[model samples]
Target chain A: MPDTAPPAPSGLAGPPVNLRNPVLAGVLAFLIPGLGHWYQGRRFKAVLYAVCILGCFFGGLSIGHGQVVYFHWQNPENRTYAYLCQFWTGLPALPALWQAKYRDPAVFEDNRLDRELNAVLTATLRGVEGELRGSIQIPPGNPGFGRGFSAPFEGQLRTPSGSVPVKGQLSALMLDPQVGAGSRRRIRGYFDGAPTSDNSGPLVGPIEGSVPRPLWDWYGAPLADTDGSPNSQLNQAHRALGSRFELGVVYTMIAGLLNVLAIFDALYGPAYGDEEVGPLGPTPGPNPTPGSPPSPGTAPATSTPVSPGGSA
Target chain B: MFPATLLFPLLAAPVWAWAGPTRTWYAIPLIISISLVYSASRHEGPPLILRRALRLMLTIGGFMLALLLLLLLLSRGT
Candidate 1:
């Protein structure tokens, strides 16, 4: 062989390996967005990745008011696909898993109220108009009952004069689970146990013996009963971000998804010119030129050299 | 001690408080971040990265705007 023999051809060859452990770099990036690039000694790129990915993630948290990022599988209706993309951003974004595990304290609180209000209002409305009319009844000694009704009462119920009954039905319907949090909370005051002392009379207690135990359970349970209020710090931070909650969610998800690309870069360096290796190694060669082979008795130039620099 | 009543206003404020009619504007920062990060990944040089990022951002924004216009026209036609 000549003094300058060509290097051995290895299948796993490309750009110079920059990191002590590319796998570690990829893992670091997966865990902390830009950490892999930082591990690879690409400080500027690392900082850029961190800022872009984290900025988007936290911005989304702020926009969505922290309520936007959560994972749930139990309720098909509540399953948020955004978390799928947001999870890629790594650690700072992991609170969503915690939020999901804890059942979103804010959402749980809202759901508790929903279950309560749904039961009570369903019973009340059914008493007034539905098939349960003349059937639903509240029990004596119930906290909700006024002292006067010791006996099981029944028949068409009436609210205090000048207070409309239909309005309560409308308000109750707004608390139904299908409604969004914003719209549901808007009507919370109307049915939140306070005397609707305005146009909707004091909620006439359900008919004695007619109201279901489920409805009363809602009225009696304490506020802290549902999963205790969400992480206060998270709640506070998200609240501060205010109306941009959905936007914050998008930023965070994009950040996470972007980190996925960063992880790939860490594992496989920058994709410069490794295109020669086809799915099945280097492609055959350029097509034969117009008339014939370059030499009268030799084969056409079908297989070109694979690597850029030819052998010495 | 801070009176709990003061906390009510802060806590009770709606999720959509500041986001009300102009929520769409939030896309600007997100797009800029995406452009910067993506371009930075391709080039090690800062100046070239930023220049390419800006170009990508403009291209993306223009495409989005065109899509929006097309959607608006379609809706009006319906």
Candidate 2:
């Protein structure tokens, strides 16, 4: 594309356009879609980029319940590559980085009352599986929360063959599967709900239940599975969003990518540089062999350029 | 329905709130934004950008529908 075009047709210069600072304009456009264009007295591109890019970015977040964009560089297990594209959205997607940094695994809620029967017991549980019935008895006021809760539980631990009645004092504490400023926690630790069940000794297993997930922990967070496996995290996220996950990811990535074009436009006029291409695009050159360059008669962007003060 | 939400989340109230309808409906806004932005990048005149963007949008929508139909036909008996 030629840098300069023929002089603009008379009476074309409407307002002053200042694209003198290419580096600054590029950087500013990168920081916020259309900002550099606005600074350069290009309101049309400014509003266009701001509306399209910001709309796409936030729209994606809402679709995925704000889980589509995050930053997780450490622990190669669950590194979030989507963040690279999302970073181009600027401030709207920046909080995830800060939230990820200060995330404390030790912080957890102590309310697991969903599974406790009227049997008056401590430590409620979520995600009650089949045949695992009966009340769990623990110390008053959610026992061993952050440091891991352990207590004896009495219930029928479901086995492959049948329900085995086993009751014993559980040693390891089991918290909910949700952490980070929540009322419950992730399902960790083991509990012997029963002992000597189907002719075996002590029924030991992970606490079972669906703990209510927290907003912060789920929003734009690279949450891993309880076993510290990265493989299932993405699956879990996809399950949560249903088929909308891919759409949300694409929307956000496209938003960032569109801003890249806006940034270039700000750094150096419009991409076509004052060409006279019609809706069908530049005049067609001779139909040449597949990879041949365009003939000079129908060059793409060699038309008259709008002066610095010309309206775009 | 995500389809309704996709079109107008604040309105439309969803005829099937429980069952999110077709995901393909997202192509409407996606194509619109993409075409407009791409066209704006290539032209200084708003009228020119809108004209090019409309053409591009129609072309993309038609191409996508053709692809979808082809895929359905190819997998008809499967």
Best by DockQ: 2
User: Candidate 2: deviation at residue B3, Å?
Assistant: 28
DockQ result, candidate 1:
0.19
lDDT of 2: 0.59
What TM-score would each prediction reach against the true structure? 0.47, 0.57
All candidates: interface RMSD? 4.7, 3.6
Q: Write the per-residue lDDT of candidate 1 for residues B1-78, one digit (tens) a residue.
A: 144433433432332254354554576777788888776654445665677677776767666655755765677757
Q: Which parts of model 1 have CA positions greater than 4 angstroms off? A: A1-17, A102-245, A273-312, B1-21, B68-78
Please give, for residues A1-312, the per-residue lDDT of candidate 2 as tens digits.
232333222111111234656567678888888888777667887898899899999888777666677777776765778788888877677766766777664432334433432231233233433444445444544454455545555666564666665566545555433333222234445555444534544345554442345466555555544456444555666777787887888889888888777876766555453445556655332222344332221223333332333322
What lDDT score is found at residue A48 in candidate 1?
87
lDDT of 1 by residue, A137-226 (tens): 223122221222122223333444432223222222212122222211221211212232344344442322222332222211111212
